[model samples]
Target: MSSYTKLRVAIEKPFGKDLSSAIELADSILGNLNSKEVFLIDHYLHKPGVSQIVEFCRSNPLLYSSAGLIDHIEIISSESIDVRGRTDYYDQYGVIRDMIQNHLTEILTLLTLDLSNLTSPSNRPFDLNAAKFDILKSIYPPFLQSAVFGQYSGYQDDLESDKGGNAHVNISTTPTLAIVVLHLQSPVWFNIPVIMVSGKKLGKRETIAKVVFKKTRHVSLRKKNGYCDDIVFTIQDSNGSSFITLPSNHNFNLPNDKTWTYNEGDGTSCSSMKTIPLGRMALKETYASVLRSLIRGESDLFVPLSNVLESWRIWSSLLLEYEEGKGEHLMIYNKSFLDNLRLTLNGSTLTVFVNSSDPQDNLVSFEKDGISFKSGNKTVEKIKEKIFGHFLYKFSRSSLAREISQDILDTAITSVQARDSFHLALPGGSSPADVYQSLVVDYKHSFPWTHTSIWQTDERCVPITSRDSNLFQLSKTLLAQVGVPYVNIHPLFPVCHKSESVLNEYASINYFDYVLLGVGKDGHTASLFPDSVNSSFSPFDNNETVKFVKLPLDYPIKVKERVTLSMERLVKARRIGMIITGKDKCHLAHVIESKDKHNSSLPFVQLLRKAKPGTVKIWMDRNICKK
Candidate 1:
């Protein structure tokens, strides 16, 4: 679908690491008579929509952030159509290498480009490449481990047949669908998750880029009529109807001019201005611009070889995961629209139909970001004003359980498979117990129960027969159901407290492959309570793997005996999951996160300080984390 025509074509062999061999093949096959020009089309830069998106993303300060303030970027490109050519080429690269790795990735760079300090747009054109490269390097390239891949039904059928439909071959496992989450590690955008998804033969065909506003305290407008005011730009055609109406609209690739119209919708916080969302013609020209750049040797219109190689590296890693658990599709947001924000908190669900309709079949609230509510009765002030922690929150308990349990299983599977015996340390608490029970009951089938071993992070030094025992709680619930052998369960017995045998057994672990921990209201964890006398004798002083500390005979809990793992030991784990619940703990969670002097007595704070950048994740119930 380009206006320009190819005068000549040359592609001799499989496309991969070395592009030279193919170029060399042409030299010998036709004896290059001093070729005049060469071009490569990484066409994302040429699409009108992508171009305008990139331009606006790079140029505008109000809409996008140059200060790298973007909390997250979600890019989803699904099409109702399928490939119409030979399956051999399509099957080899699949949707990942064919579309996502190149085109979609380019869009990511444009969406997150850091041009904030650039005093002039003139310098940004050249600095853009460097900025993007820095962003990718900060993230250390998208890893294959963070993505999932799939194929539609006919994709395999096509792969089994030739162009003529005469011969048949074994069906190949090339993915026609890919969903990945990329993170940025820059100083300004650290730990930001950029979710990118692509597929063919899907329910609809639309390319979309949605930038989510951060959770920072943003101001809202309360309308005079008791409703909240908002603002937005709309695109219209000559008749002032929605700009895209018919199928032919897809072919309108001409330059935008005075014919295009723009207007404001809903709340008008800002003045109405002219704006045209990227159109098809503009998208087509986006790629066409690359063709022109190729003739001129302009790297501006394409991804560099280094960037391309980094993408391939990420894709290669993703291939291994897809090969094994491709069917374990999480469906994280498969049914949910990106624009619809449906949050469930403490039995209270607030759903805003900002952009999509599929969700709101039964929600109490509705409206778009820039539009006013149908009625002003449900004003923003009707709800109590409160400040949840300024931190991220997840309100759904089921979601929290699902995500954390899967994370544990994934880690256990990978670890136990890599080593003869993988160790997982568990903490005793309500939220942790809930997740453990969920894993034992609901997700029991998903665990690697054979090669894994369980270790209690802290134990009530009472007899296993005592109700105060941590192992007793785990055994009655998760351990009782799973098939993991009794020998694999390593419990810190009260007799082992202050005994060298405990230290020897704990030391043999090398490190816990996974750790499931919890945060208490007083900022305490693993029996290491703040302001407690034993807090001073904490293992953090010497980084001990295991510590035996006895509390006063009248200590707060029923049992005075305690045996616990140290921050030194938990930090060595391959991954850690901290489950925090109750909105009351949000402020405490924020304080514990700081690891300040006051929080130094908390064990979870110490573990976080010693852990790797991406090794630890806190799964808190949003009902507690939110106001």
Candidate 2:
């Protein structure tokens, strides 16, 4: 007998009335093996009598100690078996057997018990010829030397006379129905086979013990973990000849004979595998692929620009032709011809010089004898409002302003409709005020004006009635007149709350469709003053709305508090239209067309850089582009 520090016994069925005979038969066989631990499992607990038998062993420690044979005994209930009817008996038994072989159970107790106390039948009759054939058919032939069997007799059998039956005579055999014990003799079978027996008369085959061997084949591949291959074995009889080998190749059709050939002598081996590219390598490859296409001019990065510019030109020309007889109105054009314009890597810095015939030629010209325009403090404020105000009005108008504004407005409105929402940042001033009034007058009949919501681009920290209050002006000029449902309009309430909270609330909204913006002669838009204090604008914040800011200027004129959309929010708009009409705006407009980051100090320059491609349209009179 080999020494095992710990013994784990899993029973297929508990010692109950239905399984009493089978348990007795199994116990007799196990007794021969001198197993120290015996475990029983079944669906139902043992009867009262069986329970008492177990309790007796637990109470008397000294009488039933580990020194005795079968030192530990345990009984447990397993609900794994599901028996539907009489036909399911085999399946239920098979399930129970699998549980025992798989060692699925909680250890109820470790009690010292004596097997000797249990009554053993005086005799057991077994068919020796049948048992031998069964044993031979079950075990692998390579391990035939490990198989063994024995027989036993009681006193009555020894006393009985041979050939003739004597009075009070009894014949007894081994106390087991069948016993097949296999002691693995080969090194490969060492610690592999123990005991295996199966018989329908034994009350269903309960336990199935399987031996699993793990063989690993190493292959070179690019991966954090090496590849794994699996192979299965089916044992049928002794001498391995009755066994079948599982197919290893996925592509090959299995042979009917179920035999696998090991290619060891053929010098054939599995191919080395490759590892997937990861980390920086993968990103670099993807970016390089895209950049390469971009550089090759196979892909266009200015998607929106192409679409918007073409649409604007076509629509503007049509509107100009339609409104020809309406009135003498402003006409703005891209003053620089293609030959004079320059395209660069940084889109913000490009310079265009307009000819004298250009509408804005005199307005923005650098000639010493030209208009010689100056942007005073008041002029700057007025310009910012006018630019933004006119931009919005152009969208609402049917004239040339509307034609230019429609390109951007249509794109924005369409985008908003697709998303089921719309938003805009309208600054407080006469220009924006006029734009709103124009929107109410022009688009009220065409769009779902009642559904549109309005918000301030920036507000002064004052009551809504105050002249500086953007919300007050918008409400009076647009929101109130358009009859846009009050619920749709979200104004900064109290007009006195800290602008930050309002800005934060604005940022929480989803994308905005259109954001009407103005330009200051000093190159400021909204409340963002170029080279002034409180001009910081964050483009990295995840919030989708505008930010509020205060301006640094002279006392009584300095914007103490103002709300404005962040550059990020403005750029994110589907359409951004800038309206600049006066001659004072020519220099700033010139800067806008220039491709220089240093020129970004101009508010419009920043706006253009951040604007979605093709979505930005500058609607100006001939005066602003003159220089």
Best by TM-score: 1
Expressed as tens digits, the lDDT of each residue in 1-627 for candidate 1 is 121223323221123522243335434534642232222356656555555544443344444433345545566676666665767677656777676766677777766666573335463334455666655554433323345455665665555455556456664667677666665544455445566777777655556555544553221111122111111111212222222111122122323341434444345422332334434444445456655766555555555444554455445534534444433332222222322323221111112222435443322341110111222234321211112121222425544664566567656655754786678888776768768775764345445677788888888777888777888888887888988888888777743445666567777878788888888776667766655544334452333787666677655667666778866677788777777787668776566545363436555566565677567776666466556
Model 1 residue 362 lDDT?
Answer: 27
Each model's TM-score? 0.45, 0.35
Best prediction by lDDT: 1
Show model 1 residue runs off by greater than 4 Å.
1-40, 62-71, 117-125, 140-148, 160-168, 214-260, 263-274, 277-288, 324-627
Worst 10 residues of 1 by lDDT: 226-235
Runs of candidate 2 with Cα error greater than 4 angstroms are 1-400, 404-409, 493-496, 499-504, 532-548, 553-558, 595-598, 625-627
Each model's total of backbone clashes: 14, 35
Report lDDT per candidate.
Answer: 0.54, 0.36
TM-score of 1: 0.45
